[model samples]
Target chain A: MAALSPGNQGVRLAVRYLVLILIALIFIFPLLFMLMNSLKPTEQLLADTSSLRAFLPVGDLSLDNYVDAFKRAPVGTFVFNSVLVTGVTVIASLFICSLAAFSFVFLDWVGRGILLSIILATLIIPFETIAIPLLLIVSKLPWFGLNGLEIGWLNTYRVQIIPWIADGLTIFLFVQYFKDLPSELVEAARVEGASWWQVYRRVIMPLSGPVLATGAILKFLVMYNQYLWPLIVVQEESYRPVMVGLGYFFQLNVAWGEVMAYLSLITLPVLAFYLALQRAFIASIASTGVKG
Target chain B: MARVSLKGVRKSFGTADVIKGVDIEIEDGEFVVFVGPSGCGKSTLLRMIAGLEDITDGTLEIGGRVVNDVAPKDRGIAMVFQTYAIFPHMTVRENVAFGLTIKGVPKAEKAEKVAAAARILQMEHLLDRRPSQLSGGQRQRVAIGRAIVRDPAVFLFDEPLSNLDAALRMDMRLEIGKLHQQLGATMIYVTHDQVEAMTLADKIVVLKDGKVMQAGSPMDLYHHPANLFVAGFLGAPSMNFISVDTRSVDNGLAMVANAALDPIEVATTGRDIRTGSRAILGVRPQYLVPSATPAEGMLHGKVTLTERLGAETVVEVGLNDGSRVIAAFGEDRILAPGTEIGLAFDPRQAHLFAEGDRP
Candidate 1:
């Protein structure tokens, strides 16, 4: 093949960057519109929705909507609840699911293959099909918390966190990633007198940074954006997460600016979590292609 | 160092037998090599000895203790894998110190042992570097270093030098030999390379189809292979096999004749040989020489191809009976294709095996 001329190379590079920039703008336009209009009055926000001005801060702006979004509902409590649930669930799910995946990939026992298949089969079943039964089960589950023995798990953080700790998607992600690792590493560790737990903690987990980041980011998105399960289970305002708390802005008046402010605020945690792990997440995707 | 022994050790995964009843005795501080073709249960037998694979039947004794059910770590063995199996996440020092850390050894003792292993491998300067930063030979050294710190009685090597380049394989092969001498430990090495088995092993075990063909000192197996498989598997160009008919059996020698040659007396140790029975005559390529004149007990053939290596020339000859044989000459010979040649070998150097004597 002949080498490209210097002029052609420059033109090719420019066209590539132009296409990338257009794709970037297509994704960024919605977030820009939300942030720009969050500062505008509700009347101006609604009026500019049809034009590009909605994506720019061209109208009268103030911090009143931010204050009003916080005032109309307990946005602080809701954000705290979502972060707590998402954070705890992400950490616990990574631990439990990775352990389960380690067993599935490395150990040999009867019924393992069938059990894994059954867990993976749940992926095809949407949450709505099991949501009612799950709600009933958690409502009657026993818990001994700071308030002593409780027969029901409703209106508490445990109800949201425990059920999401061991899901098929997270375990499947870990199983596929663990399968790609060198089996010789595991055998070498075993021959060196390492217990199974020590092998998982030291040898396996140290090399699992990419998969851990990938699993954390995925579980964070799923838990943070949860609406129905928590909505049907918890009826208390104090235990309301961000997605359920978004209902407070949809009153009879329906303040669009305040609604945008609430959305923009809630989106921060998700963005921060993704940005912190984007390097490893991108690496995982590049290597494994998002098995989930 | 400790002696290792396998007494009727058999391994079967479900109904398929991988190592079918293998028995071997490895003396203390001896270097024994398990050599065979791929899928011949050489690696499977090594893994069974290492406790990485469970033994389905029979007993394995290490230092006079039956350890059939013992764990790998408790069996007092360390292994260097073909892939090196060095932890990519850890530095050289950390990798060597892993076993010591698992044992909860004192910090000072661990550091001193790591330094000693590093110095032995001449990798003290690379102790802080990760495995990714090192060359293939260096990573293999780190793996050996990790095994060295464990101070086990027996060391297992599963085709460790197969991953190296030709020149590097030779260099590492010498290093492993020197390491065996320095440590004076019982080392059971597995490889399919006959050169490695010949040069490095104090004792060689040849296997085929999950059964041991023969096991003995290298020269013993070379000079007197128990079966045709050992004869063919041990040599470089491999022994040339020609079908022959036995005319008479007297004492321990048999009178054999073929269509390409006159009757020749070849030594046989088989008790089942009978007159008017078929057999195979085996001769090494190095022993066959071109004769100046056609004579009795000489094979008549036409030269088909010649490989002129610098020191020696190898000629492939087609026998008159429509069979092919190779001959390696010490001095280069200018024999072109389609040239008639007469090949002769000493009777004592030829081996005779009864037909259907596989093991």
Candidate 2:
């Protein structure tokens, strides 16, 4: 291929940038529409839906919809519950799944291959198939709380966090990444007088940032968007997550602006979590070919 | 700094028996090279001595203490892997200091030891760079630096230079030889390359099928190999074996007859050979030469292939009995393929193996 002339190169660059901007707009326009409509009144929001002004903050802008969204539901408690549940679940899942994967990959034990296959076989079974039985099992599970020896686990934070802590996909992702690491490094550390725990803490874990970020992002998204399980198990409004609390804005005369405002609020945590680990997430995807 | 001894050491996995009854004594401060073909249990034997592999039925002693139950880190030895095992996430300085740091060495002492090792490896300037930024040779040096900093009793290298290119392998080989000389440490090196074993080892151990074929100095093995395997394995363009029949001759010498050449008499040197019994004659390529004068025991063959290296020329000859023998000559000779030539070697340079004996 021959090199293009300077004038042709300029035109080519302009076309490339135009294509990229258009692609970016396709993904971002919905979020932009939500954010702009969140600042508008219901009337203006309904009217602006027909024009480009739906994505622009140009008409009757105010924080009244946000205030209304909070009044219509316990948005503060819902946000707090979602963050706490997602944070605890993600942190705990990373530790548990990575440890499980380490055993499956490095240590030689009898029946490991069969056990790994059985765990991976669970991935093909959809959660909807077992969700009802899971709910019934968790409803009667005993726990020691402030009052001591509670028989039922409904309307509790542990119910939301514990069930999502360990899963097949997260363990599989960690196993793939750990398998790619050179075994010689592990042996070298062993010969360097590091115990297995020291090797895991000092050597393996430091090299595992990409996989951990991948696992955490995936677990965060799954736990944050929890709706069906929480809707069945959590009857009280105080323990409802953001997705289940979204029903409050869908009354007989639906408040469109309040819906958008509540959506924009709930989306902030996911956006912040993803953007925080954006580089590592991309690195993990590029290395493992795993998509979240 | 330490002597390693193995007595009847064996390894078996599910009735396969990878290493069967190996026994050897390595003196203190001696560089020993375990030279063998692949799957010869050389690396497994080394791992058993390093305490990385368990000894199935025998005892392993290092510095006069039985250490069959000891861990690798407690065996007073360090290993450099075939793939340089320096941590990719750590700087060269940090990698060299890892063993000491994990042992809770003082900071000043750790820094001093790492610096000393870096200076010895000539990698002081690249101490701050991670392994990914370094070249293959530099990474290998960092691995050696890691081993040196521990100041272990014995150093183990598992085909450490096999990953490098030819020129770099030669340079690194010289560097390792120099390191051995300067440190005077007991080192066990393993490789499938005979050139490396012949060049670097004070004592060479040849293994095959999980058994020691021979063990001696490099020249001792080159001059007098115990069996056919050692004779063929120790040299490039390996020693040629020709089937011959032995007969009684004058002065108690054995007369050898073969289809490839005329009958020749050789001194048996107290070997048990009966008349009319079959034997094998072993001769190296360097000993065989293209001769013009008609002589006794001269073989006639056609030159099938010729490799003209600048310093010497090697030619493969095909005999009437469908056997091939390679002969090396000093002067450059342009011999075309299918050119008939007379090849001859001194009787004293020939080796005889009994027909029943195997490697």
Candidate 3:
């Protein structure tokens, strides 16, 4: 801090450091306020709501906000619902996308050019265009899907997962990932007399973990953040995921403070999942090397 | 281990025909090299025989049975690709065992076969390494080991050494020649390098534009090339072709005049030639000599460029009529640029092609 005139320079340096500290505090202050308020008694929280002067409400830094959050909006059930639905969908998307990618990249199936074109065409078709019809179809009975046979999507897990599977984004990710894989590897497997499944299972799958994890993580984030679709069909509060239930929870309880607690709860898992999957994504992109 | 035959086989990618009616008969345990310039369908023909490509027409037989519709795995053939198509994900051991494993061979036999093939290819120390971890030569060795473990009736190699450095290429070339002899398996090797074709093959199948130009012993093709393409394709610093009028010499030998020289008597018993017919005289650089005395085979030309290959020097000479010719010399021989080199040819080794065709 010492420079020119020691006293004045020290004062100037302190001011510069204070400005940087103030900027940092401005960003972190709101989160600190929320966390502290979440711990405060309602009476004190409302009295000085703008300040961050409160300590833990209970002697042992009370977990009352968490307990209240679970009771008020079915947090446990909502989280479980999210993990199950999104987890299964991620797994299924990875499987289906990997299979499609395997087929597109390696096998000499006829009309692959046309098939690839159709799949690529899906990429530009936004999910919003299909959302209403998809929800309507999911709300109703299914029919003539294959060989004129009837299928149903009414209030079923299919209502969420099927539409998500048909999402072009996932397939595009897989196809792009698979397209760069070495064709020589597949040719080698073929020369070794491996059936297509063996090639996909033994070679492609083991090698595709990074992209698969990335694709799965992406799907999980989308399905986790999803509110509109779940809001329309998931009438059962227990069946509702955290995002949709967060909306309904606000309308019913009006617990702004507790919802912040809920927001914190919902937000951390998504961040953790993203962090976990990001490593895989980075690894996948690295190993794929350069793509033509 | 067995004979292979490709009869009237044709392949067309859409309307553009790549292989136009090729027929090649490979005898039991013979190493046949397919040599051609790029886009000449040599690799495509090898792929056809390997069952990697559809025949489109006619039949491919391996071990004496048609394999037109047979699966590549079931075709009694194994192929080593130019890229050394070893599975990057698998260790050398696994790559070698993959064929046996796919055939549902017992784990014990798979291990035994893989080990034996590894030993044969001298890749036992690298059994645990993936293809990416190995050098280009090692990867190619593993690829050949993979083929060997199959104990296939025929082995197909598609430019397997094109990726290696020159030193490694020479090493692998000798290794492959030894492999052919040791395995006693019918091998159809495709390479654009005629030296590989000459050194490794019992019979060399020269191809061009999807058709077989000629198939014969390398020496036979060298001494008596069937056509211009065969003569041009068979050698490095390739054979030189100088056009000349053919005339019957005294002792019933057809002598081709070197314009500058008196005459070169070519040894051929044929009397079917019509007089005054034009022919292209073909002679290799190694056979051309810088004559000591002015006489019979002396063809004078000025040296244009000289390339020394340690043991030998190759001199490209421009003739008086502006046509160029090449002469190969031992290191002791010296020629400077613009110096007139009195070149002579061995008449016995001299060849004549009628107009566009070599007889």
Candidate 4:
């Protein structure tokens, strides 16, 4: 190493940079180890756990674990169920939240303050605090138009979509966002002879690019990796999200090699999504802090 | 262009009254100014007319149509705010054409309107740049261009020049005057500067505590002020008031005097003026002149303070009984502090305020 200067300022700067790199490496080592573990053979894993030599096969390698992972579980069926429920919930939640938020903000309804207070009050409550009462409500779906249209949420796909909107956190996020938004922009649009729907579609929605990106990514992650609610509601093998299926996989087949490959497979989509949405994630957190 | 009127308009925030029953009638194509001190409810009244704030009481009529419940866009008025509220994300051309583009105007016609507005404001060179990239004066020009593109019947400016520097403010003032001369749009401007009101307005409205003190032309206000507040507020260095009583001179002629002056002629004959009324004489600083000795309409005093402001001297002359008045002088003034001096007044220019009457 080069000799540090006598003054402590240069030494401090060098030490801080080195510490940051070390912390980053420590945080990232688990993913690297997991990747290496997924590539090793059974014999080599039994031989050594901490050596680089054990990561590759001795003579020839095969994609046997991936094939076995697909055989032991209906991976395609799980992915379809996950994507379908998550897709509907994301679109529905965004539309409902933005509409309600715009109404509470711009329109001078009589009970606007009370409505906002009730929405804000839900933020202090956690979803787990109301899970039992929520499950009771979802088990008996409201009769809107037709008879025998009940959505018995235990072991059903409808269970996932209802809880997504019923969770007050999403509405709270939208309301807080709409409250701080500049009303001058909305007024200008109204002055230009635009209807309320036109204003929301042309002006409010276009201006909410960053918030929507962030909300979509956050909601997708929350619903994609859901386990507790899905476990309580879904009992059938074909109706669960991919995360619940992975947990069921470990219980039925105790083969650690196949399990490791399956878990790694399940993590790829979320990891890719994280990489794609890092910018939106940072903007949402930083800007929402300024909204208040 | 449209004329605007406010009949018995009032606004209150909870228990506090801000605008209390203000009525003003502005003529068509006439430029009027609302001038007052801060916290005088001037800006709030402008917002009520724009329909940005709800009218708590009374009616607001624009071009003879009641618009108290109508939305801001349908009010046929465009406004420029004090903070230069141009959209920071749009180009200068986009900002100018935003109102028409929202109205679904054709692209070719939108371009023509934007081009015409930019041409009038002389801002054609900076159309492609964003507001963040333009200078303060350039941004203000772009703001005025935005108002012009909409072709509003009544243009509302809420202290638009306050954000600019002094030199740019003067330049933009000249441009606005020329624009008014060309367009002849009905405009209502609000400012605390009396100079701006004097220089730009076809009529000036003086507001005090949410009430209109007086409304007239600049020269009418300067020459014939309805009360003491208007007389004191309109001029630089303010008008000076000396409490004097009416008395009989050697002949049957009635003259006015206080303590340090010879009697001055009084031709005022009204029931308000009598022998025992507590009346004060008002005179501007420039009207008082230094006299070599005591002459008709002359007063004697000792110089207390001398303020030389490059062009003229403002001398505070103290009377023998310890009251002082300011006198503006030319470059040749030689009065010094602690020196005796005499001054004369023109009786025709003096204003009288009775004790119990409004100024």
- Winner on DockQ (2 vs 3): 2
lDDT of 1 by residue, A150-229 (tens): 99899999999999999999999999999999999999999999999999999999999999999999999999999999
Q: RMSD, each candidate, Å?
A: 1.6, 2.5, 5.9, 4.6
TM-score of chain B alone in model 2: 0.97
**DockQ-based ranking:** 1, 2, 3, 4
Best by DockQ: 1
TM-score, prediction 4: 0.85
Q: List the pairs of residues colliding in candidate 3.
A: B1-B185
Model 2, span A219-291: residue lDDT tens? 9989999999999989988899999999999878899999999999999999999999999998987877643
Docking class of 1: high
Which structure among the candidates has the greatest TM-score? Answer: 1
lDDT of 3 at A39: 66
Using DockQ as the measure, name the better of candidate 2 and candidate 4: 2
**Residue B134 CA error for candidate 3 (Å)?**
1.8
- Model 3, residue B64: what's the lDDT? 79
Each model's backbone clash number: 0, 0, 1, 3
Residue A95, model 2: lDDT of: 89
- Which runs of model 1 end up more than 4 angstroms from their true locations? A289-292
| Candidate 2 residue spans exceeding 4 A from truth | A1-19, A50-52, A145-150, A289-292, B249-252, B269-272
Report the C-alpha lDDT of model 4 over A134-179, residue by residue, as the tens digit. 7888777653435565555577777887668534566666767766
Which scores higher on TM-score, 1 or 4?
Answer: 1
- Which candidate, 1 or 4, has the higher lDDT? 1
Q: What is the lDDT, from 0 to 100, of the residue A89 in candidate 4?
A: 84
